[model samples]
Target: MATERMAFDDLPPAVLAGVESHAGEIVKAEMVSQGFNSEIAARVFTANGAFFVKGLRADHKRVWTQRREAEVNPFLRGIAPALRWQTEDAGWVLLGFEALNGHHADYSPGSPDLPKVADVLSRLGEVGCPDIELRHMEQRLERYAAKPSDLAHFAGNSLVHTDLNNENVMVDGPAYLVDWAWASRGAAWLDAAYWVVWLMAAGGHDPQSAERWAGRIPAWQTAAPEAVTAFALATVNVWEEIAGEDPDPWTAGIRDASRRWAEHRKAA
Candidate 1:
C-alpha cells in the first residue's frame, strides 16, 4: 500500500474542519502517511509566520496517544518538535509548527549522515522520561502473539519513537524527530535497533555501525541481554504482521536483527 494513491477529498469531515479552524485559509493540503498514522498537512499563512497544520485521524487509539504525547512534549521540545495544540471537539488532533527547512535523512549506502543520525539517537537517550506507565514491549508482544497474523512483532515498553524512519526525521539546524502517534515506552534499545534495521532496509548497509548504535543504548548495557532480545524480537514480530507479504525493507531488516538477537539470547 506504500505506492497506492489516496485523495485528500476522502478525508473525514472532522479532519477537514479541524484544519480549517486552525488554518484560516487552507492554501494546500496533502495526504501523507508517516508510518501507521495517516496525517494531513495543511498550509496556512498566520500572523507570526507560515505554519503547517497537522491533523491526525481520530482512531480508536488517537485520544490516549495524543494525550500521552501532549503530556511529554514539553520535556521533548529540544530533543524533538513540540506539539502545538490538540482539540477533541473536532475529532482531530491538531499540531501547528514552523515547517522544517531541511530534507529527510537518506539511509542509503555511502550516505554521509549515518554517524550524525547515530549522534541524534544518542542525544535522544539523554532526555529523561517521567515514570509514567505507558505501553511497553512486553504487553505489545503479547497482543501481537495472540493474533500473530493481524499484527507484527511486539517490543515492550521504553520511551521510543517507534516510527523513526527517514521521513520522520528532518535535519533543519539540528535533527528534529517528528510523528508521535506510535511513540511509547518500550525497550530502550528497540528504538535504535529498529532504526538500524530501517536504515539498512532503506539501503543503509552499515551493520557494524548499527551494532555500535544499538550498543550505545543505556538500556541494552544495563538490562539483561535476554530481556532486551526478547523485546526486540517481539517488536519485529509485530511489524511483520503489519507489513504482511510486501514488507518494507525496514521491516525485513528488523526481522533479521530480531532473529540475530534471539539467537544471542539463546546463547546467553
Candidate 2:
C-alpha cells in the first residue's frame, strides 16, 4: 500500500507550493514531533527512489543552526549522513536528503546496545567542529543566569548536542546522531551526562554500566569526574527552567540527579 502524503494545515500555501514543485509527487508526509523544535516531512516518489523533504524554520537562530551543521557535516561524513540540499523559497527553508534507515537509541534496560551507544557518543565528541560565532555558550549562559532561573554561574564551551536524548541517536550501522538544531559548543561531558539522565528516566539508568562505557571514550576518560557531574547538574537545571509549563519527566529526573551530584562533588 502506498503511503499518503502528510500535510500541515498550518503551513503557508506558498511553502506547500514550493514543496510540490520540488517533490514532483508527494507520496507520504509525516510530522516529526520528537523534539522541542518544529519540523515537517514530505516523501516523494521520484524516478530513482523516494526522496525525503524536510520543511524547517529559517529564522535567524535556526538558519545559524543549519549553517553550522552544513559546515561540520562534510568533515563527519563517515560518522553519519550529511544534509544534501538546502533551499529557501517563499518563506520556507526546504531540505532534501536521502533518508537513513535505523531506530533511535532508546535502549531498554540491560540491552546490549547501551554501552555501544555511549561509545558512539564518545566518538562523536572527537569530530572536529570549525570555529563559528553564531551561538555563544558563554553569552547564553550569562543571559539565562541573569534571569531568575536555577541555572546560574554554570558555563563551559565544548561541542554538545544540547538535546541528546535517546530519540536523537540511531542504533543501526554506525550510530548516527540526528537533529542538529540544538548542536552547539558546550561542555563535552554534559552530552554524555545528558544521555545518562535520559536513559535513567526511560528506566535504563545504570551507573556501573555507564561508568564502564565512559571508560571506552578517551575524551571522556580524561574529563574530571567533578566537571562531568557539574555539567550534568547544570544541564538539568537549565532544562527545568526552559520547560516552564510543559515539564519533561526526563529533564525533571536530570534536575534531581544534578542536585545530588553537586553535593557529592562538594564532599570530594
Candidate 3:
C-alpha cells in the first residue's frame, strides 16, 4: 500500500520547531518520492546546508522501524546517508541525514550501475554484524522457511540490508544503502541472494544470468549451493504469504521470480 505523505508545511508546529532547532531555519523543503516507509521524506534547505529527513508519528505501528534506522546509521557510514540528527518531540519521531545529490540505482540489464552496486555490496559483506540487538536472518524468515533446520544455513556474523531493491539505494559518487529498518545479521552471502530476486524483477535476466551477477561478490561465490537454494525457496514462500493476502501485481511478479530461481537451483 502507498504510504500517506505529509508536506513540510503540514508538520505540527512542535515537529517543525524541533527540526529547525537542529537543522537551522528551513528555507526550502522538497518532498522525496522514493521511499514508501516514511510518512515524511524530504530534502530540507537550512543555513547549515541540505539534509534529508524522514519521520513517522510516535504511536505508529512502524515507529520501531524509525528507531532501527537511527540505530544502524552510524555503522553504515559511507554505505548509507550520514545521520545528522534525530528528534522525538510533539508526538513524532524524526531522523535527519546528509542529503546526497543522487538518484535511485538502476538495476535493469546493461545499466552501468550494476558494477557500482556490486562494489557497495562487496564492501558491506566485509563488515561483521555489529553487537547490538538485531533480528537474525533465521529469526526474520522463520515463518517462511520450508523447514526449521533450513534456517541453520542463514546464521553468520555479517550485517545485511535485506531490502536491496533499487529504491533503497542511491547511485552517487558511490552507491549508498538507505532504509535500514530491515537490516539483519546473517550469512554474508544472504544479501547477494536477496538482490538476485530484485534483479530479475527489474527484467532481462532469467534465473541463470541473475545468479551470475550475484556470483560477482566473493561471499556469494563461496556460499553453499544448497544453502543458497534454501534461501531462494524461502523467498518464494514469503512472497506467497504476502500475495495470498493482498496479491498486488508487484508482489505476484516477485513471487514468480523467486520461484524461478528456486526451481533453477533444484535442477542444478
| Residue lDDT tens for model 2, 19-98 | 55665545555555454443555444544455555555675344555556556565555455566666677665776656
| Superposition TM-score, candidate 3 onto the true structure | 0.96
Select the stronger candidate by lDDT from 1 and 2.
1
Off by over 4 Å in 3: none
Candidate 3 lDDT by residue in tens digits, 176-267: 89889888899999989999999998889898888888989888976888899889889998888877966788888888888888888889
Which lDDT tens digits does candidate 1 get at residues 1-268?
A: 3322345455667665665566555555544444444344544454444564554555634545556666766767666776555555455565665666577877766566665666677766666555775666555557544344322233433467767778888777667777665666654555776675675456545555555656755544655644555555565666667667876776666666555544554465
Q: What is the TM-score of each candidate against the true structure?
A: 0.71, 0.75, 0.96
* Model 2 CA lDDT for position 54: 55
Q: Which stretches of candidate 1 lie over 4 Å from their true place?
A: 1-35, 57-63, 131-133, 143-158, 204-206, 216-220, 245-268
Question: lDDT per model, in order?
Answer: 0.59, 0.58, 0.89
Each prediction's number of clashing residue pairs:
22, 3, 0
- What are the C-alpha RMSDs, in order, of all predicted structures? 5.2, 5.5, 1.2
Ranking by lDDT: 3, 1, 2
